[model samples]
Target: MATTDDSFNGLTEYCEDCDLETLHEVSVQIRTESTKEENAQFSREPYRVCECQRCGNRSSQRMNNA
Candidate 1:
């Protein structure tokens, strides 16, 4: 299983330590932005966290919704 949230599954990403593309288990985290303004709107930023299945290396990337 790639993730429990079903964001990214069965994907291969670049591993710097492995020096090649390898299969990774991916998980997503949505970070909410907060402002000091009482009426300020909030936005969510999604980040994908990847862990190499072979080498146990972890990496994260920000996702662009636009």
Candidate 2:
């Protein structure tokens, strides 16, 4: 069998313990910014909770809409 690293591009993250960036899975998505105000300029930022594929450790990254 053969494997490829192409699929792991965006899905991978830096593993501190592993001393390298490895594949990760998105565990949960949390909205860091509130759009409930319903203002003229409402922005929403999201926090992506990711889990390390090898260690099962969790980490979060805030992503903004571009």
Candidate 3:
């Protein structure tokens, strides 16, 4: 499974207020079970949440199915 930091690498740019102009080096893990309706194929994946280091801006990026 990919960690939040892994997803942060996918970030192409920083926010307007970002001073460092780079993604933070923090990892946040969130785990939950999905209902049948949510994942009909029973596919489980990790969702990444990232935050900016300077401006405290937050964003999320989902991993690709590949």
Q: Estimate each model's TM-score.
A: 0.55, 0.48, 0.42
lDDT by residue (tens digit), candidate 3, 1-66: 222444536443456666444655445554444667667446555556767765788766656445
Q: What global local distance difference test value does model 1 have? A: 0.72
> What tens digits encode model 1's per-residue C-alpha lDDT throughout 21-48?
7778879988665565653356667888
Clash totals, every prediction: 0, 0, 0
Q: What is the C-alpha lDDT of each candidate?
A: 0.72, 0.65, 0.55
Better of 1 and 2 by TM-score: 1
Ranking the candidates on lDDT from highest down gives: 1, 2, 3
- Candidate 3 local accuracy as lDDT? 0.55
Off by over 4 Å in 2: 1-10, 31-45, 64-66
Candidate closer to the true structure by lDDT (higher is better), 1 or 2? 1
RMSD in order of candidates: 6.1, 6.2, 7.5
lDDT: worst 10-residue window of model 3: 1-10
Q: Candidate 2's residue-wise lDDT over 1-66, tens digit each?
A: 112367753477677877777777775464536546775245555676777788888877777657
